[model samples]
Target: MTELLLVGIGTGNPDHITLEGRKALQGADLILIPRKGPEKSDLAELRRRIVLQSVRDGMDRVVEFDLPVRDPDLPYLEAVERWHDAIAELWAVTLAAHPDAHSAALLVWGDPSLYDSTLRIAARLDPTPKVRVIPGITALQALTAAHAIPLNTLAGSVEITTGRRLRDTGWPDGAETVAVMLDGACAFETLDPDGLQIWWGAYLGMDEQILSAGPLEEAAPHIMRIRAEARDRHGWIMDTYLLRRTGVPG
Candidate 1:
């Protein structure tokens, strides 16, 4: 049976890779990098850079494959599930092509245990390869570090949710602070903005990183404008933010 290593590379920073993650990459017989199309070519390039920096053996074992796109016509959950199946099948085909490779690695953007679905897709592999995960810094960590702020206020809780939920369900009941992820839409604009403060970051650990913070009312428009400009410039953007109700002690 093949061994599959899911190594967390962290957000756009080579140094964010843990020693364990680097070791996993070096030891793997094959490294699979997914190409997410022209709009996000930088992502694949970043992974390639990380692999070259980590592995001493060169690119002989490295392989690149096109990532499957989720169908817009299908329901969200169904589309994700079907897309995952296609990825698993592709993985099997790629691995089968290299009979001698007993260990293969994929560099995950953040910890697989977080919002990532790599582990779920790996479970679909027929014959089920032995999966190993090497944890790395998460975007939340990078965001908090970049802003020099604590993730949670003193003696308070932090709720993590998506932009869709924030827009549809409003603030989670009784959550003093909420961390929003995968928010392409500025869902914060939907909120009342009263008694709210926001800390936002995009491209969190990279040179192109952008940050905005202050009362949600005052910062919302600025964040939205910059987010649009950044997305237009790069063709893609990954951002997360924390919204805290005022009156919470630091």
Candidate 2:
């Protein structure tokens, strides 16, 4: 049976990779890097840099494959499921090409346990490879650190949700603070700005990082404008934000 290592590399920063994550990368017999199209070529390049930095030998073990794109026409959940199946198939095919490789590794952005689907896709492998996870810094941790703020106000609760959920279901009831990820749309615009404060960061832990914060009403438009400009310049973006309601004691 093959061993699959899911190594968290954090948000595109080579330094964010933990010592354990680097060791996992070095130990793998095969390293699979996904090419996410021209718009996001930088992502693949970043992974390449990490592999080069971590793996001192057998550069030939590193492999690149095209990532499957989701069909926008299909329902969201259905599209994601289908896309994941395609990725699993690709992984199986790649692994089959190198029968001698007993250990394979994939570098994950941020901690694999949070808002990541790599583990789920690995489950679809027919032989069910032995899975190992090497944790790394997460975007949430990077965001809070970049802004020099705690995830939650003194002893208050924090709810982590996606941008789509925030736009669809509104703020989670009784959550003093909410952290939103995978938000392509500025979902914060949908909420009433009253009593809300926002701390937003994009490209967390990278040199291209940008940050914004303040009362939601005052900061929302600025965040929206800058987000658009940054996406235009960089061709893609990954962002996260924390929203806290007023009346929560600091």
Candidate 3:
């Protein structure tokens, strides 16, 4: 039976990798790194550097696969589903080619549970590989740590969700802290800016990271500009943010 290990590598910083994550990397017989073309080559390079620095054994085979691109012609959900299916197929082919390799690992950006479909794709394999998830620092954790702020207000709760959910559902009821990710459009513009504070970060934990926080109204424009410039320069951008209601918890 194929054993699949999904290792969370955190947001772009090599140091953000946990001790357990490093150990998982060292233990893997093969490491699968996904390439999203030249536009996102830096992402693949970062994972390579982390392996070079963190793996105890230097010779562990590292494999790269071209990531499947989502079709723009299809609806968003359908496009993503198709894209994930294609990725799963590539994974199956790679695994079959390396039949001798046991304990294969895939380096996941941030945690696998958050806005990432690696786990779901893995589940679709023919025989269904035995999966193990090694958690690492998530983008939300990295964003909060970079700013030196607590993720949740004292005695309050935080709601973690995606940009699409936020845009469709609006502000979550009874949620004082809302974290939004994978949002290309500034969804904050749809909400009431009054009494709302936002902490936003792009490329968290990376050298080129940009962080800003304050009233949503005041910071939204700056976030948009920074996001645009970063995407233009890098051809891609990964960002996350936290929104908090103005009033303190009682």
Q: What lDDT score belongs to each candidate, Candidate 1 first?
A: 0.93, 0.94, 0.89
Candidate 3: tens digits of C-alpha lDDT, residues 1-250: 3689899999999998888888888888898888999999999999999899888563467988898889999999899899888998999998888888877988899999888888999988999989999998999999999888899999889999888888889999999999999898888888889999999999998999999999999998898888898899999999999999998762
For model 1 the local lDDT of residue 213 reads: 100
RMSD of each: 0.9, 0.8, 1.5
TM-score winner between 1 and 3, please give it.
Answer: 1
After TM-score superposition, what is the CA distance of residue 49 in candidate 2 from its true location, in Å? 0.6
TM-score for each model? 0.98, 0.98, 0.95
Clashing pairs in 3: none
State the lDDT of candidate 1 residue by residue for 157-184, as single tens digits: 9899999899999989999999999898
Which of the two candidates, 1 or 2, achieves a greater lDDT against the reference?
Answer: 2
Error of 2 at 17 (Å): 0.2
**Candidate order, lDDT descending:** 2, 1, 3
Instruction: State residue 55's C-alpha deviation in candidate 1, in Å.
Output: 0.9
Q: How many backbone clashes does candidate 3 have?
A: 0
Q: Deviation in angstroms for 151 in model 1?
A: 0.4
